[model samples]
Target: MGLRRLDIDRAALLTALTARDEGLLGTWLDLRDGTLRALVEPDDEAFEARLESESDHYVKVPLFTREFRLMAEFVEQVDDDELAVRLDQALAGPSAFRAWEGVLAADPSEQRHWRAHRESALEQWAASWLAGIGLTAPWTDEVPAPEVPALLALVMDGPVRRALGSDAEAHTTYVRACRDLCELLREPFPSRRVRSASRFARGPVVIERSGRDVTIRLRADDEAG
Candidate 1:
C-alpha cells in the first residue's frame, strides 16, 4: 500500500458547511471531527468496497470525502491483486452511468430524429429521482408533437442559438434540472437486476422487483418518437 498526505481545502469545506443540504453539513462536520480518517487510511480493497456500498445521492461534503478517500487509496496502490479483484467487481456491476448508457442504447430511433424526445425522457427521469430525495423541481414539458425535419432541427439545435427558441429554452431548463438532479445522484451503487428481455424499451422502465412492490426503474434508449 502507498500513502500520500491528504489535503483538505479549508475554503471549500466552509462553503459546504453553509450549504442548504443537511447531508452536506453532516459531512463537513464529520471531516472537521476526523470521522473521514477511516475511509482514507484503509487498504485499497477495503476502501473501494466501502465506497461500493455507499449510496450515490450524497451532498457535496460527502461527495468530496468519498472522492478524497478513493483517491488516497489509489495513491497507495496497496495489494495490486486485491485492487484488481475489486476493480473487476466494481466494473461488472450496473452503475448509474451504465443506466444512462442503456437509455441511449435502447433508443431505436435515429439520433438526429429523436434527440428532443430522448432529452425529455432523460430530464423527466432525473427529475423523478431528485424528487425522491426531497429536492422538488418542476417537470419538463418539451415533448413537442410530431414535427417535420426542419422544425425538429430548429428545436433540437436551439441550444446553439442564443435566441429564445423552444429548443433553446427546453435545453436550458433541462440542463439546470439535470444538474440539480446530478448533485443529488452523484454516487454509483448497484441497481436491482433488470429483466434482460425488457432492456430494450424506451424511457424509464422498471426492470426488477424486490421486496414489497419496489421496482427499480432503468433508463432505456428505445423511446417512442
Candidate 2:
C-alpha cells in the first residue's frame, strides 16, 4: 500500500501559529509544513518533545538558523558599534533614533526571546520597540492614525531597514499599516469574497432557471464592449 499524502490547511495553521497566545502544537504543525498530521493532539510533553526535535532538525539543517542568526547578530553588532555613532548622530540632529536614547537600551528578556523565538519575538519587539521609541502610544492604548507616519519612520530607520535591506522599509510599512487599519476597521474575520483579477476572469458564473420559459443572453466580447 502506498503512503497517503498529508493534507493540511497551511494558511489556517499559519494564522493559528501567528496568534499571540498560540499553542505549541499549532506552531509545530506549521513548522512541519503539512508533512505530519497531529494524532494525539497538543500538550506540554508533546510540545516540548516536538520542539526539541524540531530544534535539532533546525540545527542539522543549518539553513533555518543561518540567516536568522546572521540577521540577529548583525543587528546586535550594529547596535553596539553604532551606539556612539547613533548617540552622536542623535545629539547633532533631530533623529528619532537618538530621541529614544533611554529606551534604546536593551532588555535581556526581549533579547533572549529574539534568540529563542525569532519570528514571534521579532514581531512583538517591533511593536514594543515602536512604542518604546515614543512613535505610537502604549500597545494597550488607542493608536492614532497621525502617529503612524512617525512610528513607521522609526521602524524604517531601525530594524525594518536594517534587516530587510534599505529599499523595503516604505513598502513594508505600507503593507503593515494597511493590515493594521483593516483589522481596526473590521471584525477579526468577515464574510467577504475577495476575487483576484485572474480568477475572476476564469472562474465560473451561476445561472438560475425558473419553471417558465427561460431567456438566455450570451454576449460576445465586441458586442459587450
Candidate 3:
C-alpha cells in the first residue's frame, strides 16, 4: 500500500483547529479504541471494530505504544506547555501528565500561567505545522486583501469568534468545530495495509518515518513492556 502523503487542506484545518477548544482536542487524540467506542456505544462490537480500524487506517506503520503515544501527545499537547514537559518526563519516569492535574487545580496562579503558556505555544505550534505542510502565509500579519485581508481573519474573527461568543448555541458550535478539527488531525494513515489490532500490544516499539520508509525498531523482550 502506498503511504498517504500529509495532504489535508491548509485553510480548512487551520479554521477547524482555531475554532475548537484546546482541551477537547487533547482528549480526542488521547482516546483509545475502548474509550472511543464508549464515546459512542460500548456494547456494539461492530462499532468497536470500526473505531479500531480507524486508528489503524491513519497510522499504517503499526506504531507501538511508544510511537502512538508520542503522536497522540503531539496533537493533544500542541498547546500545553506543562503537559509537554511532563510528557518528556513520562518517557523516562513513572510520573505522567495526569499527575499534574491535582496540583494545577489547587494552584490558580499556576493554572492561569499554564493556560497562557499553552496559547502562546499553540500560536507557534500551529505556524510550524502549517509551514511543515507548505503554508507559510496563514498566521502572518500581512494581508492579500481580495476576499479577506488576513489569512487568520476567517478563523480568528469567524468561527472561533462564534465559538467563544455568548449566544445560546455557541457551545454547540464550539463543540462541532472542535470535533471537526480532531477528525481532521486523526484522518487515517494513508497506507492501505492496515496492521492487525494485535500489533498495538508489541512494545517497546520504536518507530521512525521519513517519506514512505516506516520502520519499527523492536526492543528486547525485557524492555518491551
Q: Which regions of candidate 3 deviate over 4 angstroms? A: 1-99, 141-225
Ranking by TM-score: 3, 1, 2
Off by over 4 Å in 2: 1-8, 14-26, 30-42, 56-152, 155-225
Please say which candidate is ahead in TM-score: 1 or 3. Answer: 3
lDDT of 2 by residue, 94-188 (tens): 65433534324454543454345555433343333223323331223433332333333334433322222333453343344333323322212
Best by TM-score: 3
- TM-score, every prediction: 0.20, 0.19, 0.28
lDDT, candidate 2, equals: 0.33
- Pairing residues by index, what is the TM-score of model 2? 0.19
lDDT of 3: 0.36
Model 1 weakest 10-residue run by lDDT: 193-202
Question: What is the Å distance of residue 120 in model 1 from its true position?
Answer: 0.8
What does candidate 1's lDDT look like per residue over 85-170, in tens digits?
A: 44444444668334333443543342223344434434443334333333432333232232232322333432222323464454
Best by lDDT: 3
Query: Candidate 3 lDDT, tens digit per residue, 1-225?
Result: 322134343344333333423332211111122121122222455644565776543211111112324334453534557655654554545545455544456657656765565454444444443343333433453322222212223344322222223433443343333333322332223222222111211223323232323333444456653
Q: Lowest-scoring 10 consecutive residues by lDDT in candidate 2?
A: 195-204
The positional error of residue 27 in candidate 3, measured at the CA in angstroms, is 14
As a TM-score, model 1 comes out at: 0.20
